[model samples]
Every structure is written in structure tokens, then in C-alpha cells.
Target: MPAVAPTLPDDLREDPRYYLRHFQFVLDWVAAHHDSLLAESEWKFIVGFGELPEVSQALLVRMVSRKGELFRLSRLDYAEIGDSDRALVPLVEAGMVIRDPLIGLDELFAQLRVPELRQCFAERLAAHGIAKSATRQRLLDVIQEYEEAGDAEPQRRRLSHWWTETTDQLVQLTVMPVCDRLRLMFFGNLHQTWSDFVLAELGLVRYQQVDLGELSHAFQCRGDVDLYLALHDLRGRLDEGESIEALLTEIPPPAQDNPWLAERRARLLYRLGQQAQRDGDIPLALHCYGLAGPGEARIRRLRLLERQGEYAEAHRLALEAQASPCGEAEQQGLERLLPRLARKLELPRPELPPTRQPRARVLELPADHLVICGSVELAVRDAISHSDRPAWYVENGLITGLFGLLCWEVVFAPLPGAFFHPFQHGPADLRRDDFVARRRRLFDTALARLDDGSYRDVILDHRQRCAGLANPFVHWELLEPELLSLALDCIPAMDLRCMFQRLLLDPAVNRSGLPDLVQFLPGERPSYRLIEVKAPGDRLQDNQRRWLDWLGRHHISVEVWHVEWRHD
Candidate 1:
């Protein structure tokens, strides 16, 4: 007979449909009774863990207690763990043994410390045609074979599933709740955001310590937690309308000694300096940044120095920083700062073109160009469909539709490491280089198609595919083969290619702001006009201006049709 599962308390048990909710319940119980459940020694170990040396902490976090009461670790994983056997002594003395049986990967590898045994395992793994790249799988396969050869040890059964089971299944057999164990297992670890959530859930760390930003790792030192908390206190005081002078007297600067803390120290000081500068205390702002070491802090200091009329110091600093090995963005910041500093220092600046006055160009509506004046976008689209010239009225679909047809593979499969992240699941960084790199292959395909005269076929295929797909950018009925063929023949290949390249360079800005409507003329030679309709009070946005500028530069025929309401 199958054994019955043990019953849990009503508070602990959850409905079958909401089984995953039980993890939250189990976490709540462990948190409530943590002090009572663990012995005094274990409690001390958990709370005082951060005080240990960073290397020791790194080792413990990499280890996970297996279902068989043994901790699983791999020699290959040690480089990232950043520790040696000496680091394990303290945990071992505390009765937290990291071990497995003879057939286990860690234990077997330990015994394999004997030269002969190492050669035997390597030979066996290799005899099975396993390359060095498949080392982990090879080890597991050899271990299984050894187990089957009459090694009747009871703990051997757990070894079979140890290397292959899910984390949740492995944690289910452990004494502690998965969440509590995970917190202890990953405390103060960098590179993964899950550890941040675990610490935050236990209330041991604040959310701001692990806040997502342009930089990958947020917390770099033990003192970072303290700095985050202190900043919170100062912000609270400021929100209550406290004076900057009064708050400055109340909070002391953070005293962090670890060299790893340099970046965090610099960032926090820069932020405080910004706050002080806004409060009209320029000296205090400079002082805060002075204590923080260089990197980005120097840039902030340069800006503040310029504001204080210290042109000589700012110019000298900018020149010094420009000579250093800096990232693309920091170099660009220094470039922009140097020009402003030059003008302030009474130095000659580069001569620029004559400033052209920006004006709204009025155009007489052509008989072929159709305008539908509706209070809303949807109403305008509906009205245009009923006109003489066949028109597909849209907000920002035309250019993107053209792009999707030209580069279908890239539109679907974004480049690895550029957009899709295994952990974060959000687009990692949409910077220009990353955006261009991810779509380079697609751009090449577009170029090849243009050269081979096969672009018409590609456009036709994409139009068909876009019609079947429920994509927002593509309206199938509007992108009929006849319409796409006309566009292919009428638009110059080089002009279209340049425009698309500009669009890919800054996708977030250029993807939108396309002309609102694409209307095709009723001629055998496929002629078309793009009209951007604006209601009376509506002006063009910056992105719209950029699109119009690119069109004007290429001498493409585009019109801005401004519409006004007429009352009887």
C-alpha cells in the first residue's frame, strides 16, 4: 500500500490548486519561529555570518546541503567560489559537514586525489567517447555504472538522483524551508539577483542595496548595507522639510576601509553631493565628492567646479580624465564637458554651421494626397480607408512594417546576450552598440537582397507572413503584394538602406515617429506619398522632427499636412 502523506496545520496547508503558495506559508512559519527552531549555536552562525572574512562567506554560499545530509560541491565550481579547503574548517567545527559517500562526485573526486585513481576515472570517462567538454556528464555516467556493479550501499541511491534532480525536490527533503536555506546559502553573493531577494525577504538587507541599475553588481562591501540605511534616514529627514545644514550636522560620513567599497563609496558620495549642490551649498558638495575616490565622481566634481566658476580646475581635470582608459559613455561625457569648459575659459571653440531658424513649413495638399480630419486617431484611419486613393492610416507602423518584412528572422529571434537574458528576462541593455550588433546579420541580409534584386521576393514573403501573424506593426490587408511591390520599385535601395540603418542605431527613439499614413497612387508604375497629419494645436515631437530631417536630407518626397477645424 502507498504511504499516506503527513498532514500539516490548517495555517500551513494550502489548497491543491494553490500548491506553490505553500512556499510563502512555509517561509512565514520559519521566519516566525526561527529563534526557537534552531539551536543557539546555529542561530549565532546564521546572524554572525556576515562578520566572517569574505572568502569564507563565499565558500559557504556556494555549498548546498543535499537530500542525503551531505553538502554537494564541485572542484570545477571552486574558482567562482573563491576559496580553498582551509575556508571550510570553521563551518566543519560548527558541525556543518560538507561530505558525500564514496560514489558521490565530491567524495569520489576527493579520493581521486590519489594520482592512480584520477587516471582511472579519466580513462573510464574517455573510453565512453566523452570529450573534455562533457566532463560533468561523463562523471555522472561513470558514477552510475559503478553503482550498478554491486555497490549496495544505502546512500548510493541518493547519488543517482543527486546530480540530476531539481533544486526544489532536493530542498524538499532538507530540514529547513527552502527560502530560509536559500538565504543562508546565498547571503552577500553577487552576480545573481535571486540572492538579493532572499536576503530582502529575511529583512537582513534593504531593497536599495540590490537595486537594478546600469552596473551589474550593486552591493560590493559589507558597509554598503550601512550606507543604504543611513541614506534612507537622511532622505526621511529631508522629506520632513529639514534644512541641509541641520541634516549634515546629524549624519556622519560612512567609514568604509575595504578597497572593494570604492565604487559604492563614490556613487553614494556623488548622490549626496548632488543633493547638497541643489540646496545651494557648493562647498559641501565638493567636500563629499573629495572623500570619494575617482571614476564617475571626477565627472560630477568637474561639473560642480565649472558651476562654481573654477574653469581652470575643471579644464585641467577634464583633460586628465580624457587621457585615462575610460568606457565609451565616460569618454563621451568628458568630450561634452571639455567643449563647455573651453567656452567658459575664454578659449576658441570649433566653428559651427549657421544656425537655421526652425519654422513650420506649410504645404498645399495635392489631389493625390488624402487627409482625414478626425478628433481621434482611429476615426481618422477609418475615414481614410473610404477615400479615392487607397490609404492605410496608422500611427507608427509603416517604417517598422517595412523593417519587419526586410528582417523577419531578427525581429523574431533577437541576438543572444543582447536582449533575452536567462535570469532577468528583460532586455538587458538597449544601448546603440548592443542594438546594432544584435541586428547586424539582418542588416547584411537586407543588403544582400538589395544587391541580388531578390528584395521584391523577400518583401512579398514578409508581407504574407506579417498578414498571418497578429503583430501590432503589421496590418496584412494594407501590406498587400501589389502595394509592397510598388514601394520596392519606387523607393531607392540606398536611401531605404540608410534610413533603416539610422532606425536600428537608436531603436527606442527611431522606431516610433514615422509618418501617419502611407497612400499608394492608382498607376501601373506604383507611386506613393507619405503624409503626417497634425490637428490644429498638435506640434511635431522631437522623434518626428528626426524622421522629417532624415527624409529631407535624402530628398525623399514627404509632406506635413496640418489640419484645422472649420465651424459653420
Candidate 2:
């Protein structure tokens, strides 16, 4: 089913308390649908929140919607909720927020301006013989230096204790952690937030209204939710430059039953391996790569072993990988590595299949032509384009856009765990291995339009109706009507079906590395050719080479244009 268009009640815009209502709607939706996922404390929070006054509720929502937990009472001015102090009373009493909470010196520095910091730490600064006019960082450094020299423990105190003369009060929201869990349950991920609702409501963004059935939820059980959160936290720690060894110990073992969680685990381990390599810990890197489940991990291990002169092990792994490659990239890597590894081990050279080379041409243009056109690709495009054929520097956008349009329904199908909320730009399992397998029937039905000569109509209709909606594959700005119409006319449906099939083989990898420009010739029996432009001294990237080879094998017209600048 197509997503329902976004509609709002007539009075929704007029109401000043619309955000409060939106927040309430999310809570109610989660409670009604995902009540089993909520914990005892979370259930109590929902019940207690409803009992609070409207002002307190509105104030709390406003705080929750913002970035951080701590907010200065004076700065939180809202016309919808009058007198924040009065509203805060109910929140503080309900234990949703903490008034005058103990905070560390680092946090105190973050909250205060230079002037405020100087005033607050005047005694400490003067005792250390520091100047009042010093920069905030300088003051902080001096104070920290003196404190460290004296071996003083870090200080934690209330706002009043830190700044005796200041009248402004600070309150820390205690409910954001629980609210985040609720948000995760509603969105199925932490990336989307409350702003998605606000954006959709204000007409700033639109979404497909997927028909989420009774069984439509992100988590099958509480354990899945807990595991997802734990993985997310570990990823955060890795990003924050945490100790690799410590973080490795904390990461949960791969979830064998759940490919989604397993993929996440593999990605984290892969990233950890990369970090270990950067740190120059070869042994640790090898261990991480060995344990990093599937995907690029095997290739990394092969490369590391090769680099360390462990040719025997590298050759063995290469042969193993050649037998069962993860994807095209990994397969390509093995093709190159195996030949070299065999030579290193003094073994008989393995006979590999001959490589296909795409048609290549060299163009000599005036050096200043680059200055006029701004890039080599554009210059090449302008030079080759004529009345019979025109080229656009589309790179990966055109073909992917066509795929997105043709498969819109299949992509947005509300499968179990595919979509948990209205704001998702695409399905949750879009890049997973089973993405196509799980929705094979829907995909087959949609692709059937191509065979019946209805794909052009279907794609054109979607372009007209769903122009501005977000899609992972489609680039709305690049898919102008003229270009789209031209592509539909010039590119054969059979060719499109072939390209779409390759894309489905590996959506995450194959979506990239398309030729830089696509030149279309429109007429009776219209045709198009894909072109990859390279400047002086530039070479084809691994992904680009793979794409060129694949396209040529499928009998799709593709070329490499190498541009040279004229010395004169």
C-alpha cells in the first residue's frame, strides 16, 4: 500500500500546545502498541507524567526536546508554559527533574561564560596568582594545574555552592534516559528523534504512511531492545576514542539468530580493527580482524597477514576466500591477492580468468578549459555533448533514482521490523542480506511492470506524485523531469532490469561507483552510454573498475575517457 499523505487537524495549527499533544501522541502510541516492551519503572513514568499539570508537561517536553539534560531556569522561557519556576515545581516534585543537582567542575565550566567563571572561581584563581582578565581556557588550565599539583580530588557541588552570588538556578532533567528508551521503541533506532514529528507537522518534511500492522514492531522481545541499546553504547564508546582492549571486552558476542544485530556487531568490530591498525598494534589488529564476523573482516586479515610477510597463511586464507567470497569487492580483492600470494610462496601460479577492459579514449583539451568548466568531468562532458547526444555528470544518481522510483512500494513495504515509525526515510533492513529475500514477492510484482512496458508509466507517475519524499536511493535534486524523461526514453527496460538486479545483489555496495556521466541519444530506437572521466594522472578506482567490468559483461555500453591538458 502507498503511504497516506500527511494531514493535520484544522485546529492543530491554531493550538499553542501542539508539541505537547504530539509528545502525548507518541507516549500513547507506544503504550498501546509496545506495552510489553516497557519496564515497570517506565510504566510508572507514563502514568505519573499524565497526572502532572499541563504546564509541567509542556515544560518537560520542551526540555526533553532540546539537546542536553541541564537547563538554566532563566534561559528556559516559553510563552506556552508561563513561569517556568512554577511549572518546574510539579516536575521536580514528581522526580522528573532535579533542582540544584551536584555537578562536576568540568560541567560547571561548560555551563558558565568567562565572566561567570571568573566570578565563581575568583577565590581559587587569586589564591593561584592568576589574572582575572585571562582567557577562560587559561583560567581553567591554571586552576586545574594547581588542583592537580595539590593532589586535590575533583569537586562536585550544587550551583549555589559554586557561585554564591548568582541568583540563576539550574535543573537537570532525570527523565531523558527513560524518554530515550521510549523514543528508541517508537522509532526502532536512536538516530531519529522528536524533531521528525515536528518537521512532518510543520510541512518541512513528508513521509510515506506505511501500514504498520499489529505485529509491526522493531523488537521481537525485551532482550533484543536491550541488546540494541548495549551495542549502540559500545559504538558510542568506540567513537569517543575509548581504549580498544577495554571496549572489545565489553562488546556482546554476535547475535547468531539476528542477522541485523550480527551485522551491527561485525561493523563495530571492523571499526575497532581499523582503529587498532591505526594505533600500530599489528597483533591486536590481527586478533580483531580474525574475530570480526564476515564482510570485510576476512579481506582485512588477508591483507594484514600479507603485510607481515606471513605468505603461507595469507595464501591459504586467499584460497579460502576465493572459494566463498563475501561480495564482489572481496572477490575482486582475492583475485589480485591470490596471484601475488602464490608467487610469494613459490607455488605454481593459479590460472585466473582473463580480465575485460572497457573502451578507452584520450582527450587533449586546453589547460585553461579546466578553469572555465570548473572540473575535468564537466569539460569532457561539454566537449562531447552535441545536439544528437547530451551528457550529465550524474555519477551514481540517475540509475539509483530510477531504481528507487520503480521499487517505491516494495521499498516501503511495512514488513515486521522494517518500519517502526512514520518518519523513516526507508526500510530498516534496507541494506541487510535478506532485504530482497524477505520481500521477493513484492519486488517481483513491482519488477513485472518492466516486462509489460508499464515501468515507464509507473516511474513517471511516482516522479509526479512522490517528488519530494525522502528515499535512500533517489536524489530528488538530480532527477530533474527532463533528465528523467530522457533516461526513460533512451535506456532500455531490459537494461534497467539488469542493472536493478545487480543493485539488489548488494544494495549497500553496488549502489556506488557508477560511471561519472551518462550520455543519452533520443530518437527512434533511442540509446544511452555510460562514461567515466579521469583527469591527468588519475586512475580507475577499485569499485569503478568492478562496475565497468560488470557493465561490459552485461553488454551495457560503457567507456573510460582520460583527459590530458595541452601544454600550449
lDDT of each: 0.52, 0.87
The residue pairs found clashing in candidate 2 are 3-209
Tens digits of per-residue lDDT for model 2, 356-453: 78999999999999999999999988988987898888999999999999999999888887887778888888878788999899989988899999
Clashes of 1: 0
Residue lDDT tens for model 1, 203-305: 4442211122222322333345445445556666766767656666655465464333334445555666777878888898887666554655677788889
**Deviating ranges (above 4 Å) for candidate 1:** 1-349, 353-386, 390-392, 411-416, 419-432, 438-442, 459-494, 532-539, 561-568
Local lDDT at 449 for model 1: 77
Judge candidate 1 at residue 80 and give its lDDT: 39
